[model samples]
Target chain A: MKRLTRMQIPYRVWMFLFIVIPTLILFVLALTNMNLYQIGAFDLTLDHFAIFSKNEIGIAFWNSFFYSSITTLICFLIGYPVAYYLSTLPNKTRKILVSLMIVPLWSNMLLRIVAWEKVFTADSYFTDLTGISLNLIGTQTAVVIGLVAMYLPFMIFPIFSVLEKMDRSLHEASKDLGATDFQTFVRVTFPLSSSGVISGVIMTMLPAMTSFVLPARLGLGTISLIGNVIESKFMKEVLGSSGMSINEGAVLSLFIMVLSVAAFMMITRVDKEGETLI
Target chain B: MKKRLWKTRAWKALGIVLMSITFLFLYTPIIVILTLSVNSSKRAYSFEQFTLQWYVDVFRDPSITGPIVNTISIAILSTIISTIVGTLFAIGIHSLQKKSRIRMMILNNVPVVNPDIVTGISLMIIFSLLSFTLGFTTVLFAHIFFSIPYVILNVMPRLKRLDPNMYEAALDLGCSRYEAMLKVILPNISTGIIAGGLMAFTMSIDDFVITYFTSGNEYMNVSTWLYAVLGRGQSFTPAAYAYNAMIFAITIAIILFINLKKEKKGKLA
Candidate 1:
């Protein structure tokens, strides 16, 4: 006990109080039939898991997964080339580009989504200017575009940093071996910087799967992603819904948690360090 | 060889074009928001004339002030607390022998790896268990809670890059562990600490998920305020448009400040 590092004590205490116990609370709340109104009335039941059967919940789950996956895929396709290009630029240009990408995150993201919402509306800014009805609002395309716009920076920076610091010697050696530029990229550069790619995907996908703001605003409150489902469960009790389904909310929470941790583990198996998470 | 040179040139042009489009896409939404804020008329999408009426309206609105105050205050407060505790935890976790270090790492990973929704509700459950009402205090704790792991993640790598021998050398020179850490280790990792604090600030400022669940209806941050208006199924007030403009202005100021400071540091090194 005396040998415990002094610094670890305070943090350990914090972890137990904030982290460990709360996790227990998640399982306990989910596994039990605890209603929101009567916190006291508790029964151990798996009824919360029954949300999986409802087609709406299932569709929402699938929608969240699909949107996030597509968002991630699109980000990579666009972001990788940008990152790769930035990596090849001079230091000053690279720094400017990278910082330019990141600075948007500090501003209000909701406002940005709201801006997209307006642009996609029936009388869009585009339509107002050009007098054409694109009619994109409330569409999946709007949600996807909103998400991709918001999350692209997150995807770019990690890959850029990784590629910037890559071993130039390896690339030179591959070229010396008579490898073409495309071959060198495919065999050497992509494989080496995959850690960054993995980190980018994980970062983008997690928030993408869990974001309610993009779906709600961009979809005009019509889309029902899993995040919207979870949010509605919480948002409804306050907005005048009976029986908050706090237990069912917990069930969905646990499900998301399980999916996320599994994704992390699977990603980590390929990339143990995943050093570019930020 | 000429053909190959032309081909490479073409590819470079294509990549640049794609990159430009990406940058354009990234910048366009925020630019539109900022441009729309100063419109002469609220309903008019065109720039028929410019007006600061929205700005005046935002300055006069009572609800805007509370949310602005709450958002900035929460961001600053949580950044301070999380940076301190998270830096110490990074040091402590790094100092430990292997077995317990792995355990601590896994625990530290929870807040990072867990979806914000899970973290929010779980924290919600605990706060409820402790009979703490959902309000400013719970929101503070929630922000601090999530921000710490972020700080830890940022600082841990810096700590890992430090040479263990430096600490031993300080101890051999008769310094206490605390003193050695302060004099030798802290200087090396201050950059990481600063970066982590910046990230924490950025995250806390932008946060809506955890803050939404944990903050009672009364304690409104910038995000929750915006969300509340959106939830009512109405577009933002013209005043809210002005507020978004202010946020963009602050973001630009921050970017310039960080860049100048980084340049100064680079020159020094």
Candidate 2:
């Protein structure tokens, strides 16, 4: 056992190098004006903080929050019942259905986003077949629909797994105690699966909150999330755009990272082993 | 009693309908992609006719083939490396005291939960800070970094389920520690390792955000390639749809095979 501990040293070093160091660098970059182009003129300045006050940044933040919240809520409302129903399913049926849910995830996400873009756009293949032109591109509804389609599985699996592994006797016990089906669920099943619900919510919300591609495609330049801002900033630096600021991107990244860590800490409080994370 | 039974039947029908709708929502985009793959139309906006020309073009086009090759090669390399290293890490972590194990799990999760944009940007920052050029090697490193945690998490649960005395018994039977690990431990946890490898491959194959930041001017996987094509406002060859459809078909086949095999094993048992 003691000898085996040596194997972890390498992984520990890898983690430190990649995870710990980069996060520290992000924090430092967020606070200072230091960037790739001007590495020698290193000085701490809180100037990047002013971006938070910008109207665009505030709107981007609000859009991220609003869209992600709606996406998560829709996923939960759809997912929880679906998960509960799936949990009641026979074994072979349940397995097949669950795999069906996950198959879309295995597809290239960008391609799927593009597919939705086609469906939402007017004069699409869908319209060619159905004779109904949606022309929904650039709408908030399109982005939300794309998001829910992409991430609903994240919501379902956690709740389903928790419910599947839940003590079946509890439901029976509640029934024997004269609880109605609704009472049994509300008092027994839902509370027990709350951890899974939390896990599912966080999983769905985090990705939805940070998603850039869906908004870029479905929103069609009408919508911008914080993620799109970060992407453009980094891309600008890469493209050598004039007035490129990686530091501003770093600030936004740090803000998102803090939100993520806070969400993760909530998960740890409920699920110590970090199970259901998948 | 009749009214209650009628209500229960109604609820069941509603449940089935809801499930059907959710599944329909999930599969609609995939169905569209599959349809568009063989559509004779060059543009995804409208269907011109039915043809398999795009499917043939998938193998013929350089841009399409190049990204397909990159996506597979990176997924393969990262899956293999991460599975091996992550298995060892899981075993190592399994040997630790409780406090350290919990701490390590928290550290393991940073990559797992961190937003892809942040992860990409942070890694991009660090690579530039180190003066390491971003391209194939950086992309490979980034894949491996994010992937190992999944492997570890998948393998950890198996390690927990293993009998504590199995290794000791192997040792008492004259097996060396290395032999004990190989003959006793590895065999027991092989399923977890395989699942983890599959997961790593899945993640790597589909990744865009991290690869986008780290891929620099040289490398492009399918997702990043699609992003680039779309970013330029160019209508890409429908070969992309063909490629994605092929992947979907292959994944379905693999999953069905796995499930069928599991069913056979269960019946035999």
Candidate 3:
């Protein structure tokens, strides 16, 4: 075992350099006045904290929470029944159905966003094929639709896996003890599957909350989440603009990171091995 | 009792209906892309006619081919490196005491859970901090950095299932430690390794965010390239649709082929 442990030293170094060091840099940049352009001399200041005072920041936060909550709620509504249905199928059918569900994921996500963008625009292929021009571009509804399409699988898989692994006799016992079907689900099945539900919510909500591209494309530049704010800030830095510095981006990133790390902790508590993460 | 049974059947029917709707939601955009790929229309906004010219154009167009080559190469390179390195790391982590192993597992899950924007920014800061040139090498490193965790995630469960005494048994039967590992352990965990490798490949290929930030000005993968042209109004090619459609087709083909092979093998056994 000791000899085997030696193999991880290289990986540890890799993680230290990549993960640990970068995280520390993110914290340092977020806390200080260090600019990406002027990396030499800088003093610690709470100046970046002023970003939170901006209207865009406030709206970004609201939009992030609003969109993510709606998306997660919708996914749970749609996904829970889908997962339960899949769980009831025979083994071979379930396997085939689940794989088919996952196949869309193997395709490029950006392209799917682009596809949705095309559909939302007036005079789209959808209109051409079905004579129904949605013209839904630049709307929150379009963004949410794209999000649900993108992340529905993330919700369904966790719940389905947990439900499948559950002891069926529990449900049988609940029914035998004079429980109604809905009562059995409410009291026994749903409670037992809470961990999977948590995993699913975290998985769906985190991505929806922090997503940049999905909103950028599907929202048609009308919507702004915390992700877009962070992206534009970094883009400004990359494009050689000192205004809206990378420190501001770092602060925003750290803020988002805090939320994500909390969610990750919740997942770790429920799923010790992260079996449902994929 | 009859009324309760009727309600149960109604619920089941509703489930099937919702499943059908969800499946349509998932597949509609894909079907759109597939349709637009063969459409004779130059504009993706509206379909003009059905034709295979865009598929032909995908081959002739330099813009599409260049990014496709970059995406594939980076995906292949990162997948190979991450798969091998991550398998070893999983073995090493699995060798640890339970307390430390859980800590390591949590640490490994960081990249998995962190939003891509943050990961991208953090890596960008690190590369800039170290003064490493941000290009293909930096992008490859970034991919591998994020990818190894997934590989570890996939392989760890397989490692937990392996019999710990098998290695010792192999050693006692005249195999060297390295030989024991190669002959005994790696073979047992080959499926996980392959699955992890496949997963790493898929992630690397589809990645846009991290690659966007890390690739700098000189390089662009398919995703970043699509993004760059997305705002350019008319220069965006329908060939992109063709390209995505082709990749979708190939993936479905590969999966179907693999399933057929597996079923044939199962029948043979």
Candidate 4:
């Protein structure tokens, strides 16, 4: 057993206060009936759960899920090819390309969302060119577009890492056996990179589901994803009297937490299945 | 053989085309914003003429300046605090036994994977319960909350790779634990810390969702200010574009510097 140092106690206590305490408060607040101004005695109630079951919340939850799923799918479709292409490049070029990809990540995410708003807002150039006025600014389509754009790098990076480590001989041997390039890619490359694909999908989907800024900004406050709903409950005073009931927000929070956990579990399970197949 | 060669060339051309298209999609909006910043047009998104008036406006306007200062202050403070705390926590965690490390690792990753909205709402709820005022302090605290996880994750890998015996050697030479940590551990992990700090600073500066929820209308960060502006159905402000360009330029410069440093280190090694 390592000896516990005197200084460690204060550090551990600090962590407990900052990290664990907030988490506990979130749980208790989710369970109790409390308003923003009234910090009275806690009464445990399932009213929040009922609120979640009612109109708008259910629809919002479904919308958040479907949007995230579609974004993840699109990210996978686009990112996989890019990842594959990057993996095939010479080392120096590959390094430069990877660096370029990550450079955008360093920029502020909100800034990027605002940049998209510039593109898709009514009377923007895109609308003019297409002739079809895509009212994308406040639609689910805009949210999906933003999520896919923001999360593309997450999908690409993992797949690129996996592809870089793939055995070159497999492809060469398949070619020598007179297999076409497409066949080799389908039979060998796709299967081999499945773990990365699973991880990338998970990484993209998990964050996409919970994202607030992009959806809230582009969705024009018309569509309330779980994130926006929760924010409204806690901060906007739109749900209950003077900042929606904490208990309701908390119940919704628990639902979100469960959804996220389930999404993660599905990803891991898929990853395991892919690994076994490989 | 000629046909095969032609096919290979065609494939290469296709790959390049695909990559360029992707790049266009990724960068056009940024380019558009930068261009509009210099455009002489009062109306945003309509290219009337070219001028530097927007940059001038951003500098001259108090409303813009206040939010810019607030964002910079919060980012700088959060980066500094989180870097210190995260570096210390990472060092301490590295000293623990392998068997006891799983829980700590999971806890460390919680902030990153937890949805930002959930985190924001939870923090808001918790702070209000504790009677913590929603202001600069609350925002800073919230920023630090997420920032520390990134810093710790970045620094810990570097710390683990360090030679454990180095600390013992320093202590045997009569150096105190603080001296050993400062002299030995810190230098090794400085790069990771800097990288993490830069990331944290950018995230905090750019964050709107968490800041929006926690800020409580006390003061405006750049993002929150922009949201308010945009919500009013006003055209994109040229000043906002200029501000964004400044942020973009800084981000690009940092990335280029990091890349150059890595290359230089690679060559030296």
Candidate 5:
């Protein structure tokens, strides 16, 4: 074992301050009733957990869950085939296709969501040019479309990379067993790609469930996701005099944190060693 | 057998069709935005001519330009900071025992896997708890915080592949620890370091949620700015589209040029 060097100390401090302490603070804040003004007389309570029972918050949770799962399902339906096809392509073309998928992922996502929002907006260029109206801007459908577009690349990359690295002999052996192509895919390809599917679900689902921008923009501020709820709780003057207090926001934020952590654990459990990650 | 062959061919044709449609779906937004940026038509739907007027407007507009400058500076500064800190942390953790290393790695994944919203609010909580005003400093700190994981992920793999003897060999030859690191170890991880830095830079620039939470009311990166105006119904000008179009064009050209150059070198080699 190497001796601990002095070089590790500063980063340890940095980590302690930035990473470790902030997480501890999250838990502490969640359990305690401390706000900006209530520095003293701190008492632990789970009452804020009851905030989830509030009709609006509960609806937002369900809305986020519904939209995110549907988005994940749609991304899989679209991405799985794209991933499989790309994996079978010649190496050069496969490389190009993979890079093209990643290209959009790098662009500023806010701009993309805004651009997508226009498709459903009144006086939209799509409607104006095609003589057809989407008229869905303020609807949940618009928000779902925006989420899918924003996260589509995330779904594709995970599945494609997993498929790319998968041993081809499995498929070939299945074919030698007198199975049809669709049978070979269903029995062998799909089962083997389950880890990728799982990872893609985690990748797409978490972001979708917690997405604030899409619902804010495409929903035209009419719809709220779990993320929007959290944002408003903190960002709005919802503390001290007239706003919802801090501890309640922490409870919601902690709910999201637990949801993602569970997803991460499920992912790690499936691929225990992080092999499925792109 | 003959029927199976025909079916396979049919499937291939279907595959091509599916691929084309998917490509169109993926490419439409960028193409549309780029076109809209240059479209000279008076209406949102009209594109009777092409002009660079929006690009000019984007450059001249103080509100947009301020966010642009802020975004670039924050991105660059956070990238540099994260690169240095993350690379150092990666080295430290690499030297640790296996159990601690794995534990540290999982802890590292927390921010990566945590939804940005949760991370944003938690940090926001800490800042307000400490009575630190949410502003540029808080946003930059948040960016650096979230960015370190990317750098560590990139660097860790390279560190594991490092030749243990190189540093020791240099040390045995009378080089000090720092000198050995500088001469022997640094070069090995340079590629990983640069890649990590670039990823961090992009993540910083593309970030909105965390910045939205931590930037308070004063600072607005291009993302937060666009998102703010976007919520106000068509508060976005075509100029915003022009800014991103220029970015997309530059990114594509650079990537293509690099790919082509690599291909040519492969042929020559």
Candidate 6:
């Protein structure tokens, strides 16, 4: 390791203060009654946990989980074939297609959601054509759609990476043994791509679970996912009359953190188990 | 044999259909926004005619213009800062031993995988506690914070691929440490730096959640501006559509330019 110089000290201090300190503050706030106006000078309290346990919080958490799970499933169903097809294409064509998949990702996320809003709103062509209006704008379906659009590339890239690296000889051998193409894929290709599938699932699931913007925008202000609930508690009206206490917000944030950590652990465990089985 | 050939062709046709539908689903909303931006009708969805009036309106309107300028400025500045800092971190981390490298990698992954909302609120709370006003500076900082990890992730992989012997050879020739780094190390890693910078700039421009929390009432970014306008239940104007189309067009142009440059270089080599 390079020895630290005087010039490096200031940069190190800046990182510690900005990145490391903020994370530490998050941990501390998760445990205490750090109110909006007061900052609660070291007063430890578990009252916030009570608020987090309420039906509203539980329901929001469940809804977030439910939506993310459905989004993951949909992405897997849609992305798998596209990934397999892309893998079979010549390299140059595959690159162009993959680039198209990523182009939407480069645009502003909020604008992307707004584009969907324009698509599903009452005046949209879908509504115009069907005449029976589907209220997708402020529903759970909108959230799921937004999530699928946002995370599709994440799913595709991982699956593509695995598929691209897969040995074609294995598929040929499976076919040569008198198995049909479908049988070859089911028995050989799908199992080999499980790592990529796991990766895509994790990538899609984590972001979808924690997404605040899409839901807040498309799901309307009243629709509270875990993320929306946390944001509302922290920034919207924590000190006001209608606002819950700061401790309550902290507890909710803590719950989210716990859930995320557990999910991470579960993913890692799955990866390890998959590796052993393979 | 004829039946098998027919079945295979049918399967291929099915594959194409499935792929096309997926692509349509992914891109239709964006395509709608682009088409509607040029539509002459006052109504949001009606496609009676087409015009460039919305593009004119977007340019002429100060409210829209200001946010667009702010978003660009923030993105450019954050890209510059993050590229420099992230490159340095990548260098520093690369210099570490194996165990510490793993630790650094884990530390870096936190920002990438952490929920944007969580990072935003945490930064918001910290900035408020420190008495920093949530405005331009806060927005810039938030962007830099999020962008650094991406830059580092992109750059570090290239750095790992770099051969250490080049530095040793430079030192053996009696070159100064600074010269060795500037002449030998920087050139080899330039592509990684450029890729990282592009990614960082794109992320900074595209970010909404963190920008929302850190940006105070004093200023509005393009994303925030769009959000506010959409929330007010205003009719979709052609100008708004043109502005969005412009964003999409710029993205396509940039990607094309980059890919073309890479292809030309490959051909030359």
Candidate that scores best on DockQ: 2
- lDDT tens digits, residues A204-232, model 3? 99889989888978777879999899888
**Residue A129 C-alpha lDDT in model 2:** 60
What is each candidate's DockQ, to 2 decimals?
Answer: 0.54, 0.74, 0.72, 0.35, 0.51, 0.42
lDDT of every model, 2 decimals: 0.81, 0.88, 0.87, 0.74, 0.79, 0.75
Comparing only chain B with the true structure, the TM-scores of all models are: 0.89, 0.96, 0.95, 0.92, 0.91, 0.91
Query: TM-scores of the models, in the given order?
Result: 0.92, 0.97, 0.97, 0.86, 0.91, 0.88
In candidate 6, position A210 carries an lDDT of 74
lDDT tens string, model 5, B56-140?
A: 9888988789999999899999999999988888888778877777667777777777888888877776787778888889989
lDDT of 4 by residue, B1-269 (tens): 99889987887777676667556656756766677678776665466677888888887888788898999999999999988987877777667776445346555655565677767776776678679889999999899987887887778668777988888888889988788888987898898898778778877887877888788876889888877776676655678778888777887787778778888999999
Q: How far is candidate 4 from the true structure (C-alpha RMSD, Å)?
A: 4.3
Each candidate: fraction of true contacts kept?
0.52, 0.69, 0.64, 0.24, 0.43, 0.32
Model 5: lDDT equals 0.79
Ranking by lDDT: 2, 3, 1, 5, 6, 4
Give the alpha carbon lDDT tens digit for every residue of A17-68 in model 6. 6657866676676566565445656777665577656898888888888988
The per-residue C-alpha lDDT of model 3 at residue A154 equals 89
lDDT of 1 by residue, A107-129 (tens): 57777777776677776665555
Off by over 4 Å in 5: A1-12, A129-132, A173-188, A237-243, A272-278, B10-14, B41-45
Which residue pairs clash within candidate 1? Answer: none
C-alpha lDDT (0 to 100) for residue A247 of candidate 1: 67
Regions of candidate 4 where Cα sits further than 4 Å from its true position: A1-15, A106-111, A121-140, A165-195, A220-222, A238-244, A263-278, B1-18
The residue pairs that clash in candidate 2, if any, are: none
Give the Å error, residue A231, model 1.
Answer: 1.1
- Total clashes in model 1, counting residue pairs 3 or more apart in sequence or in different chains: 0
Q: Please identify model 3 stretches exceeding 4 Å from their true place.
A: A237-244
Write one digit per residue (lDDT tens) for candidate 2, span A45-77: 888888899999999999999999999999999
Better of 5 and 6 by TM-score: 5
Worst 10 residues of 3 chain B by lDDT: B229-238
